[model samples]
Target: MNYIKKTDAYDIYIEPSRKTIVIRQKWKYIWSVASGLPNWSYLEKKAWHQKADNVIWLQWGSHFVFWALVHDENNSNVSLHKKEFNLEFDIQWVTTDQHWTANVKKIGASEDFGSKVNPSDKKIYLAHTDVKRRIVSNINQNTVKHEFGHTIAVNDEYGKLNGNYYDPIYVNDTKALMNVGNELRARYIRDIKIKVNKMIPGVTFATFLDK
Candidate 1:
């Protein structure tokens, strides 16, 4: 009736006859930040991609993931490993680009564009121009989880399509994780659903609405 395939990056679910595919990721993350002296900004703008931090992997990863795994849904809307698309996740720590590697910098997006993935390389370019730090920010983690949605083919439900990124038309739509909010929806799984449907003819992803 259903088949599940696990990998280092994601778990693939396939119901061939029914043509339904659900992909849940188990992301291990390592972050690179600009920690230089007064020149942190200059270095950050230069856009240097630093190597992952080992200590961050140890502390942040364990705390965020392990705690989420043990806890129940206080509010699944903002939680990681839970989604409206029949998706869930498990995150650990790793120092590889193949994993959820982020360039946490005080440049780009954070001030405006928000976070985005480099489509060519499939790497996360997280904008940290806001908070001090949040490594171990993947899987069930809200911030990282939102960005991860992009990597696995989730689209921005915010302003991009309606107009420019500056448009506030969808600002109020931020309750969904893909938006600037904390929820997940069928549209978040749109791209992946298409890909899956292509692979297995007639596979349909059921749609759902928020409660």
Candidate 2:
């Protein structure tokens, strides 16, 4: 539960008019040392997002999760996926040895719903593999962006479903990316811009939001 330091630079940039934003990210797939590395391409493909303008690009050496997993010589109390930008996995074969299961889990207190976002910390935790799989299958999909929505302080519209208090505006709007669908609505974009503006001052999102 790392809080976002006021001094920390914003990790996201938004352009409300064009409805696009860029999120900086890093990733790591932790497997048993016995398990050889999985194909990076397959992982990348699964994690690819199909959104037309939104992007979540990987930034090397910046994935705190990967670093903690690899460097936990003492196996210290490392909270996976529950902390900032951390995604942890335990490798397992699916149908065959060649096939790998992307089993993801959260390492902290249980919530009425699933997944969480700490805007101050700029982190999104996908609590279940089903959610993670969906996200990896299409990284730029609404689910991924929905979590990104949390990183920017966007409140959840759906209540129990996503572990937050209910909000009618998001729940009734299926097209709203922050709710429970794949479409990215204009309102969500505008909401995000407003939130980002308040969270991070003195930054201009390239005219990407204008279009």
Candidate 3:
């Protein structure tokens, strides 16, 4: 009973009129995924969103649901950091193992939506399953960004874009975010920088905060 109708590019918009489930902005939401470490603050203040309009946090169902109910006010209780950013993620969950088979599936979420402007209220739903598995840092970050790319309505199908640019190969193992010491991490940073160049022009994270 899972009906997936592809929208434009990486954007998968589910019409609320068609399905019983509806996710809207301006509401505190949650997913059912597990967060290995607390304070998903890494995403909140990061310079990663200079170009994107919306971002979604997809994970296991339990994790999503728990976070949604517990720590959404000012996104403060959720983080240990003293200074909090004006951040909120429209959380969603995958709920089953099968749902993870999409073109850019992760544990319970896909980075498959976009924001037209900074703090864009446009929504993106991350999908993930209830299944549990070990997710190391590099693997986790790759999955996170890949799906985040989807959230920005970027193409999941690599062939459509410049092969030299959005290479999925860079997301594998050493080239992943979890593999911090690897050259791929350097490459990933460069890729994000290129995206920022398009989004914010000459702005750099160094101008705002340290990494």
Candidate 4:
């Protein structure tokens, strides 16, 4: 019956012997309006649902079990299981018709369009332009998974710090999800498990997988 205080960050609370750990995620989708575009209601709904689908793809291929429930302002009554780990995301969509600079504040305004997790607020932000680009390039799911990985404290596999790669282990792993535009890889799963184990006390990926 151990309980961990939930902060503005992802937190896990579980019994030492519990084999299955469910990660519950809540998502909020926002879209900016553009002139001459399709109806805002329809476009927003489609984008929001597509984001949910992309996140589900991540959960299905990852090592841990996640019960991700995404909701917009309209549909918020979906049943979500009570779980040990939880994450929240604010996904924003900026239409192509609007200038990027004009909407930077709403798009999370970073030099890198890479998504980030705000541990202080327990929220992840994904830029609209980044999403649209990935969608056009047919790599939306991969980008989605990469951003989600950051929520669990996983470092960018392709990122550099002080001229050194964050995780040299993944330097050559072109298919590592944490790497730029890469697919899911077993090593990425293992990396996530290691990070999660360190974050949550008495909960290990081994136990979850064994279940």
Clashing residue pairs in all predictions, respectively, total: 4, 11, 33, 1
List per-prediction Cα lDDT, in the order shown. 0.44, 0.35, 0.27, 0.44
146-195: candidate 2 lDDT, tens digit per residue = 66555434677655552547676556765455666555443434533444
Tens digit of per-residue lDDT, candidate 1, span 3-108: 5655434556654343334454433333444445233454553332221222222212222111112133453323322222333333333454354455555443
Which whole-number lDDT from 0 to 100 does residue 195 have in model 2? 41
Which ranges in model 3 have alpha carbons more than 4 Å from their true place? 1-125, 128-146, 149-184, 191-211
Tell me which residue pairs clash in candidate 4: 8-122
Q: Which candidate has the top score in lDDT?
A: 4
Off by over 4 Å in 2: 1-9, 12-113, 127-142, 159-164, 191-211
Ranking by TM-score: 4, 1, 2, 3
Residue 149 lDDT (model 1): 61
| TM-score, prediction 4 | 0.48
Kindly list the per-residue Cα lDDT of model 4 for residues 1-211, writing each as its tens digit.
Answer: 4434333323344332352333334444444533444444666667655764456444443344533232332433222222333222322233432111112112333334545655444455555543433542323344555666665556777656447667776766644667665554444345334444554433333423211
TM per model? 0.46, 0.38, 0.23, 0.48
Find the candidate with the highest TM-score and give its number: 4
- State the lDDT of candidate 3 residue by residue for 1-211, as single tens digits: 2212322222122222332112212212232224442333434323222212132333211111110122234543333222211111332233332112222112325433321121143334433321222254423332443444333333332322323444354333443323321112223223322332232222222111112
True lDDT of residue 13, candidate 1: 69
